[model samples]
Target: MSHGPTPSDVAAVYLQQGPYAQGHDPHGHGHAEARGHGAGGPAPKRVIVGYGFWIFLLSDIVMFSGFFAAYAVLAHATAGGPTGRELFDLKRVGIETACLLASSFTCGLGYVAALQRKQLQTQFWMFVTGLLGLVFVILEVLEFYEMIVKGAGPGRSAFLSAFFALVGCHGLHVTIGGLWLATMMAQIWVKGFKPQIMRRLLCFNLFWHALDIIWVALFTIVYLLGAGA
Candidate 1:
């Protein structure tokens, strides 16, 4: 004759039921651990890296926000010195903005090439992006030199100080980004789109895009508005 269900078999059936249908584990233990209420599983390395980088990016943005606030407060404090409308050159600013924006596009293309494992295309696009960034930086340097020669340097007044601090900070970031692109190109050449290298590339793309966004804000608030004022 067939035997009745044993105690262990009954316990298995209970566990097979929905989690909420049972108040606790059949073993008289809390269901928290089984229900993923305890420590989470170890995150993947990619996820960990991405999360850390996002925190870094957010902190960087906070710093920029502080700078923006300072610049806004001091934008009109020229103290009888050259104003933004008198000192700024819209034609050059337009060209610099164009180059930087174009570089962002090429940077995206390079990232796509990297994901496809196209080493040559990646290198080509990254090189183009770096060249464009370089051009933007050179234009910025020329603008600074022009201002300095015209007695409108950062030390000239509070307005100049804030303008230099804000614009110079962005220029510095672009310079770093160009260096990062070069490093990525070299790494891809030697390592061939390895997972870790791809992660770095992804981070670089985020960083470069962030710079683009910041530049847009700077252009709008500092350049366009300042010029109008």
Candidate 2:
């Protein structure tokens, strides 16, 4: 087999192509060398990040699927506690859902602001989005507290357990999202929305949008369908 370039030969190649094109195997590993020599055209770091994030999302989806199956299994085991039809207030849930949806929209606008380098506007919108998320979580917490106080706790029924399991997980995410937004806002004030911050924003966007998708399941599976049947 033609073993191609030694270090000296690769140095000649590097000299010919210049530093940008001649990918230095910073890892000093054979795979790095193979990548540079391979027909794959020297894969960029962004490609690695993209592929990694994709696997992360897929694993998250698998985890969520387990929750969904649990919910399905426990959907009808209301025990003696208040059932979905008896307990769910669609008008109120609708309001909370809309608030969360609107927060996601404002988050998108905030991303645009960061892209344009409008630091103040970006922080302002991020805070607004965070506040909306906070409001959503507060409402959910209020609902749960009121129910548990009235003895409709998760311990009262498998249905309630699954309900809290699915929807409460979403509420927890919203709370974390609020904190993340607040942190990002502070980082913007201190460091400005640089490329690294922009990457973070993209990751948060994925999280925010995933929350919205999960809420769709809560709305349909836990609320609309449950209430109807």
Highest TM-score model number: 1
Per-residue lDDT of candidate 2, residues 1-229 (tens digit): 8565678876775677554454455323333334444666656655566567767877876777888899999988987668888888888889889998998899999988989999888988888898889888988998899889989888999989988888887788788888887888888889887767777777777788788888877788889988887
> Which residue window of length 10 is worst by lDDT in model 1?
32-41
Give candidate 1 regions above 4 Å deviation.
1-43
Task: Estimate the TM-score of every prediction.
Answer: 0.83, 0.81
User: Model 1: per-residue lDDT, tens digit, 29-52?
Assistant: 445334433344456688788888
Q: How far is candidate 1 from the true structure (C-alpha RMSD, Å)?
A: 5.5
Q: Which lDDT values do the candidates have, in the order given?
A: 0.89, 0.80
| Top-scoring candidate (lDDT) | 1
* Count of clashing residue pairs in every prediction: 0, 0
Clashing pairs in 1: none
